[model samples]
Target: MIKRKKIYIEALRILAIFLVLFQHVPAFDYYLQDTSHVMGHLFFTLIAKINVPLFLMISGSLLLNREEGYREIFRKRMIKIILAILIFNFLVYLAENQFVFDLQDYCLGVFENGIDRSYWYLYSYLGFLVMMPLLHRIAQKMTKNDFILILFIHFVFSTIEPLLQWFVPTYLGQSFEFTWAFRIPFSTIKEIFYPLMGYYIDRKIHIESIHKKTLAGLGCLSLLGILISMFFTIWIGNQEGFSDEYLELFDYVSALSAFILIKSFFVHYEAVIPAWISQKIVLLGSVTYGVYLWDPFFRKLFFDGFDQFMIPWVGGFFSSVLWCICSFLVCGILVQFLKRIPKVKSLF
Candidate 1:
């Protein structure tokens, strides 16, 4: 039987891809030191920060409640994921070779370093898949209070500790061994935290009964979180001669809140949608993984290609928007082509 799709998951996937694109806006990186473009940097950073968490949450919502055995999960779910990672890593090696000319070095680097930093999500997710059986085992045994308490600890370590470490040296004059202890836990917890939260919410919370104002309130808080992120970025950038990387732990609050709001929004509104638009939306959503894998390549292409045409005419912000749209269209078309290939379709 063909299983019915959840509207919210579809919506979340589409949202995540766009946010990922926003994060990659070339101007954000190139113009980070430009005071005039601070607003642009902050806007993109806020949306980009949410992309990975929301993507993981969507995966958790879809996969955590499944009845399949470990072997089946590996065979059915993870095989494709692993394949995609390998394929994309090879693609990245080829892309990077254009400048370095060292085929041997690039081959070794692909396994050690990411094909691109964006591919970090793929490896993180692969690890998450391996750990899911154990995670679900723990989740199944936990009481509501236990779940909340664990999440509290995760937040403290993942978000709070990192934020504190950034400012702690200025006050304390040096880093401590205890800081590393806290930091080490985040390396383990970071990948699974948002997904586990999504799973818990999907398996436990009832989103339909929640007041709509709750969602609205969370949406507002998300906006506030972005503004706070902006100020913090500027403040920290100035602190170290505009050389320090902008810190954005504040994204956790808004990312989690936005996930809940999006979930609730779809649950309440999805039922009234027309079939035509719904199918179209779901179709677009289906190609997101491919879009993510190919986007970096096309981003480089269009960003460079449009430099002469769009950048000169429209400026950086609008040129970036055009680049993003063109990348999306190209990726969508490419993914659809990949889907038709018998053996390769499964990788996407």
Candidate 2:
């Protein structure tokens, strides 16, 4: 029997896609450069950085529980990703080239420079899928203590070290360098950690058992930590010229905490969500991948159009939000439509 859809997971998926759309909204970029609404834009951008990790975590939560063999994973998961890259990259190439298809240019774009910058996650995800079998094995064999140890190592290296490197010089007025001898590549660590945490949370921990007050406190603290880190990073950058170092919010402690808190909230209170709303969430969640692929194209369109008809009062964050909402709905609808077509459904 087909397993029933998890409403909370679907809710998180929808939220992730929305965050993705919000992050790519050009208004954030405009305001960041303008520096008038820097904090507001930066705050939202940092929060949105959780989008990719949340997606990865959700993947782990769903995928690690399965006992699918390598053949099934290849046939079902890997093939679809490969097809999406080929087909969507081609579409992106066509759009970029004004529908004048050039095989040479397309090949170069795919093999050399990426066709679209936004689809970087797809490539990363393809890598993750390649390693999923090993991840699954580890997930199956590992105890809770093992999972916790791995997460701790990831937290120390991925999150804590960076925070210290950023925080120490600015606040403490001292040089601090802490390097690990057995350094794992960050991309590999990220691919492993987020999903592993997701599996751990989903399988080992019971969200419903956690008190609501505790979760609330964590959520608040996480948000505060994220804002403070971002504020200081931006402030220091202004003082010492901008660097992408700690300002890159993904895999940060606060962001991960926020992700877990949000996940917990959804999972814990999932029963109270209205059935109608739950259904809607599932439907939208189903199309998030397609929406993600299609969003950048529409993002460009809406960004340009919004700029052309720019309203003075709504020029900043509000306009960016409007652009994201419009793009999300349009892309979601487009994806839903595409899903109905026989030839193109699978690729989408």
Per-candidate TM-score against the hidden true structure: 0.87, 0.88
Clashing pairs in 2: none
* TM-score, cand. 2: 0.88
lDDT (0 to 1) per candidate:
0.71, 0.73
Residue-level lDDT of model 1, residues 306-341, one tens digit each, is 766787788776677677677777898999999999
**Considering every candidate listed, which one attains the maximal lDDT?**
2
Which parts of model 2 are misplaced by more than 4 Å? Answer: 1-5, 164-181, 185-188, 249-255, 266-268, 311-313
lDDT of 2 by residue, 34-93 (tens): 576677767776777778888888898889878777788889888998787777788877
Question: Which stretches of model 1 miss by more than 4 angstroms?
Answer: 1-5, 98-103, 166-178, 183-188, 243-246, 300-302
Per-residue error for 332 in candidate 2, Å, reads 1.2
